[model samples]
Target: MHSLSAKDLTLGYGETVIIDGLDIEIPKGEITVLIGGNGCGKSTLLRSLARLLKPKSGNVLLNGEEIAKMKTKEIAKKLAILPQSPVTPEGLTVYELVKQGRHPHRSIMKQWTKEDEDAVQQALESTNILHLQDRAVDSLSGGQRQRAWIALTLAQQTDIILLDEPTTYLDMTHQIEILDLLFDLNEQKGHTVVMVLHDLNLASRYAHHMVAVKDKKIYAQGTPEDIITCELVHDVFQMKCNISCDPIFGTPVCVPHGKGRSVGANQKKRAAI
Candidate 1:
């Protein structure tokens, strides 16, 4: 397993800085959720940490060495990152897409071997997509396609996985199902998992650790039960909210109270007036 650390990292685009002087240590073999309002640099930070974007200042360290110094293929062998919406090549079957994940470990002279085949098969089985291996990825539903992409990442066999909004296109049921699969991957296999999640409740439910981002930096980081509070929600999200223990999981759940006038409340008050 590998531990990820960002040290005084600065992230931005062109000349404007979005987040500066940020430092974070991701726990090994656990699910770490990053939550923040839009434009707060959650995605940028994840990209920087994943080595897809270089930090203007400071560095991201994998294990103990700086990531920027590592070769791309070397990094690919140890870490795999899935962006919010990975594009699927037209006509690519689920099996073909997943097989791409093994490229980092392959050589021209030494092509696909028994071990590579087994990895692909195990990845499909682990993600419960073995039966769909022959299906065209584009023909699958949003949830199934997402799982297929995830299976590809699993085929990489990396110790650290960074996922940006793994639940983006799915309905609530599929969101939970995908997250449950990820949870088992962490709990059962002990792979270090880090993801960006907009749903605070789901983050609390599935994540072993939470990092709240606000104003371009980590606002707070800890167990949901310890760091998720009414004030944190208000400050981080700019929304008043009530914090309560989740009914089933006992983790902190956020109930947002935003600026939009409640239609029902407005009607009731108008009738009273």
Candidate 2:
């Protein structure tokens, strides 16, 4: 069964609808990436799945139960969401921030226990931020800070994790690092990961299942090989592109046609000669 799904979900702000009557099911224990152009409702859809946004119509389901009816803490125990560019509280250490993830698991009558401590430690270790746990979150570099934030979600010990543009503002190296970390979490820990990503090539590289959002609905969704094509990219992103294969991963790669210098055919012939 899908651990997370949206049934006829309609989301918007005021009267401007962003997503209208959308249905999606996130495959359990896989990486699902939502891709689309700006203002195409990718983030809006993700937020609704996490119950961060209230839908105007339809329902979000978690393990076959309606998510809107579930208690906040109960939902927190099963799902963790890292929003886009989250603000770090001033002077908060990484350890302290990560520890906050345990709040859903804690109670007024319950004291901090070994289980909680272990969860926090494991989260830091999983994100490879154990060494920076004592450092202030604001002091870390972009990559380190992103990892620390991921550790916070990890500390929640949920089976499902959702993130909105987790790699935003990070350099290429850091983006790869963050995606690789999430890939490992899915492969090794069997966690269901869903995120909105802007990079088409990277999304194809890491996503086992990909959903392309366009025109307030899903344009297409499936494995990259099955759904990612020149037509889909042009239709969803409004760009012309060639679909190629990644040499290393064999995933579909989008080579967009845009203005750039071109090597003349004569130059290539002369160079070869």
TM-score of each: 0.94, 0.96
Query: Per-residue lDDT of 24-44 in model 1, one digit per residue for the tens?
Result: 999999999999999999999
lDDT of 2 by residue, 1-273 (tens): 239998999999999999999999999999999999999999999999999999999999999899999999999999999999999999999999999999999999999999999999999999999999999999999999999999999999999999999999999999999999999999999999999999999999999999999999999999999999889988998899999999999999999999876779768988999
> Could you tell me the TM-score of candidate 2?
0.96
Off by over 4 Å in 2: 265-273
Q: Lowest lDDT 10-mer window, candidate 1?
A: 252-261
| Candidate 2 global lDDT | 0.95
- Residue 19 miss distance in model 1 (angstroms): 1.5
RMSD of each: 2.7, 2.2
Candidate 2 residue pairs in clash (backbone atoms < 3 Å) = none
